[model samples]
Target: MVVTDVSRPDAGSPGTMPVRRKRSRIPGWLRGVIWAVIAIAVISTASYSTGAAALTSSNTASTALRLALPILLCALGGLWAERAGVVNIGLEGMMILGTWGAAWGSYNGGVWAGLVAALAFGALGGLLHAVATVTFNVNHIVSGVAINLLGLGVTKYLANLIFAPVSGNPRQSPVVPKFDTYSASFLSDWLGGLEKEQRVGISDVAGILRGLVTEVAPLTMIAIILIPLSYYILWRTRFGLRLRSCGENPVAAESLGVNVYLHKYVAVVISGAFAGMGGASLVLLRGGADYLENQTNGRGYIGLAAMIFGNWRPGGLLGGAALFGYADGLQLAGGGEAVLALLYGAVILVGVIVVVQLFRRQWIAAGLGVVGAGVLYAIYWSNDTLPSDLIPYTAHFVTLIVLAVASQRLRPPQADGQPYRRGED
Candidate 1:
């Protein structure tokens, strides 16, 4: 029997390996870029044709970047873990701990101190995960679940003990210091025009660019910088190759004198560090708000989706993050139709009602569809817009559509969740 390198899709299958598609000639990152360009072109054309506002504007671009940063960092963390052949479901746990650490640090020292605490706490969580998965050879998923549970309990308990007495509650912390956001006046004027709030011009490009360059968090700048840095480190460094090899085939790497255990530990720990910083960045963006329980929400899971969508490459991750972030920002941007924001919200609201009623049972669902249609008719009777707060649910649906369509191209590491030992056959 042949012992194949497990990272490749065709590794153990030999003759059964699949052929590539015609479009496979285009790399995944390039494909994503092309699709993005096409999407912008199509949306722009439709907007111009209908005499509507531009699909993209300075406001939406800025908000999307802020939304994308945490998810991008978490996705990068996932990339590191999976590439090293470890399935790290513990990113959520690490992020939770990071939030607590950040709150404590900020409350005592300052925002920068909170950042340090977040990284340290996150690394500690990674260490625990690595010990369970790598050292003891436990199931990766099980280990991750356990870490999440522990993180939840420990953070809450610590928050009560440390912050509750002071803030008078176990669920929240005292406010932390904040970092200043910066703006560029020239970029705002040149790239984002002053008066085309009602029209689409070639100048919309400048608006989007201005949003990207100004009124931004310092951490957002750092996160953007980290994207290129991650790509270079993972693809170009000698240590990275060894780390990837450990994921693909640890036995082969060991045979070639690589330190498989060390690499796995390093990858997991680094992943945790990134996750922790992601939590800190999130809170810092709020600018001195008390850290509350469950603040990370489900962004960690979204990061995993982004990792899959990116085809597990750094550049692809960037594209994936941007797409998801833009989707998230759509509600705020009224789906890029400032005039129709309310109308869109009413339609979406009724659609959600129909879906939920249907999921509860069949007859009730059918009834809801009829009632929903009537409600929809009533809403468009005046074609009036709805409140911005009512439109906040748009991103979840946008995420679903994007994931359903884009996940078709994903290919995960072959032996990602497999167990291995130094002398395994």
Candidate 2:
């Protein structure tokens, strides 16, 4: 009997069975958007409980905006690096260094001097990164790790040496002058009840709105403005073109008459300077430029994630940073333990499921996973003690994870990370 096996196709036979074509899954971008919407809906529903209702006010929203500013600035700084073909992993270190410089400068000179000094030192750090990664051709990741280590050591040493006192009293640096919070002023004007002289309660919706708009410094505005400016520079300007070329294909760009080395240097310097400004903002707004060891608190890394989440676009970074900032703000707003825990776990689980489903495209699996997580959170909340103060932290953590995963699905420009070497393809 001339029975042919249907499963196996003969190598040289004309009657070979055709291979089945695999269908393309949904685009990552579309999946991400859908997941994001789902996650937001889940969070909103979870926050609709009586306890969460008490927490959701104008004040809470304002606080979320206020916290978002510094993160936005840091994300911009990171964006500068990534856009120019370098990954800046040392944002945290740059921030710490800037904080130290700004604090020290403010203590001796003034706030303006502190700001300038911070930028200068930040530029210097960028130069170091440039030299290590671009000029010497070192691994960018290792160089960043080195910078973080150096920043930690140097900032700590300076803080202890300068701030630590031999006597009973420790000498400290002056605080940055408070800038007008336009958001707060506008909110107050719009809300119509808050008095200029009245001490508004933090928990009050009006109070929170007032605090965000009124208390946020002018630097925050600067950070927001940088978003558009950065986009223009990166996509519209000559220098930006050269910078991008170097990162995408240095040899090719170098061959095509672009100064790959110089462009890389400029990119790192710009990135470092922005990161430094972010650090200075912290001191000026919150801690004062006095050396606080590890004051940056991983905002630098968060900034990197923001850049990715924004798909390396300057304008998009603002939203990404704000998401993280909102998380941090939620953690700070102190709520009841059980409520906070439930909220935190739910948000995080939703974020994770959304990210995974977006990447893997297992819609059914993802739905089941999220459902399981919700159940687990319910069980845990029934037995565990949840703290209110940790709400913002939990929120920020969940948001950051979401941003990170979403960013991976984003399609960056073709020439994003290659150095522009002249005459090379």
Candidate 3:
């Protein structure tokens, strides 16, 4: 009998067996199809007259970053909860609580105090989720729902109680101060002739680039720093491993000497803290907090979508958040025209699709995303007139369908929604 050479590759010999190439998981034809679709869409869209304007409007970097920041933070929070065996359906409620806390804190103690209070309150809310789900063994989904309801009701009641209708300034909350702009002297020195201009002189492209890049917001810098730190803490550290293990198989993790309960509690608390900070960022950076019901405005859901789009990765979450932010900026800049609204909707839908698909196949997904964006541009340019109100509704409906279908096929981690249990895999 002849011995097979299967083990020959691992034998201690130099240059004895051929090196096996890693097989490509994605098919070539599929990639080709995706690329083709993207190419066609881009060419068609670019040929249209309004394509330039739409692209320019969509690519405004500052506006996109600002809009994306809160969603990014929220998604990161969700990532933590899910990674640690907790399903946080109550992110919306948490956001409301945070907003209310920040407002109350700012009202009493000022902006700094409001921020600290929001983080603390957010952690408290997380504790609520952990106690109800982890300790009591209640259904995670139900617990989340309950927390959301409690948050909404409590926040509203508190708003009324504190800033009642009797007060003329019922809707108002203390505003946080904005960051200072670059000093005139610094700007003038950096960009020659800027001293003569009101803000920064726009003599050339270099000046414009300097102006755009130089004016860094505090939150923006914070966000950039947090992304890598979050990634490191979640994947590279021992604590992160324990948290993941707990989520994936709580029983096994418990048997391995991991404190499952503590991990779950910590995860939930962190989730809430980030969410609270996000709420504060929205109010402080965007505007002062107000007592409007549902003030978070579906941002929680948006954050959830972002988490899925990001595949629960910190860096990916930031990218997803930025895309959504760009969508928002487009809506703001386009002046609510029917065509513009439709175009914006199309862009968002396409972006979501590309991100989700990219998880399965990077090149194919990239091609498709490019194509989808191009198609949206063409649609905007081809139309001479668009109905404003109907466009947003229509776009929203289309996006909803696309997202629903995409989500159905995208599987989250196996331990995504389970509570960490003590001992036994």
Q: Largest TM-score belongs to which candidate? A: 1
Model 2 CA deviation exceeding 4 Å by range: 1-47, 53-55, 165-187, 192-212, 286-290, 336-385, 388-393, 404-408, 412-425
User: For candidate 3, lDDT tens digit of each residue in 1-425?
Assistant: 23334446444355455444566676534643564345334322422423333323212434556667678878988899998878888787787788877777766776677777778877778889989988988898898888888988888777777756444454444344433333245653565344124231132322323333554566556767887888889889999999988778778778788898898889989998888777767665542244456778878778878888767777556655765765565444444452354464456556756776676676655575667677666766666655665544444443444344344235465777764445434
lDDT for each residue of candidate 1 in 57-165, tens digit (9 for 90 to 100) = 6677777787787789888888998899999898888988888998899888987898899999988999999999999999999999998888899999999899988
lDDT of 1 at 254: 92
- List CA RMSD, all candidates: 9.2, 8.5, 7.2
TM-score of every prediction relative to native: 0.79, 0.74, 0.74
lDDT of 2 by residue, 1-425 (tens): 23345445563366554455467797645765675455445544444442353233444555566667656767887777776677788777887788878877766677677788788878888889888877676777888899989888877677677756532223334344433344445566765354222323323434444545655556766777788788788879998888777666666677778877777778889888888888787776652334456777788888887777777776567667767765665555534443364455464655576666757786665665566556545645664545555544555545544443343457665655444433435
Better of 1 and 2 by TM-score: 1
Better TM-score candidate (1, 3): 1
Q: Which pairs of residues clash in candidate 3, taking residues 3 or more apart in a chain or in different chains?
A: 38-371, 251-424, 252-425
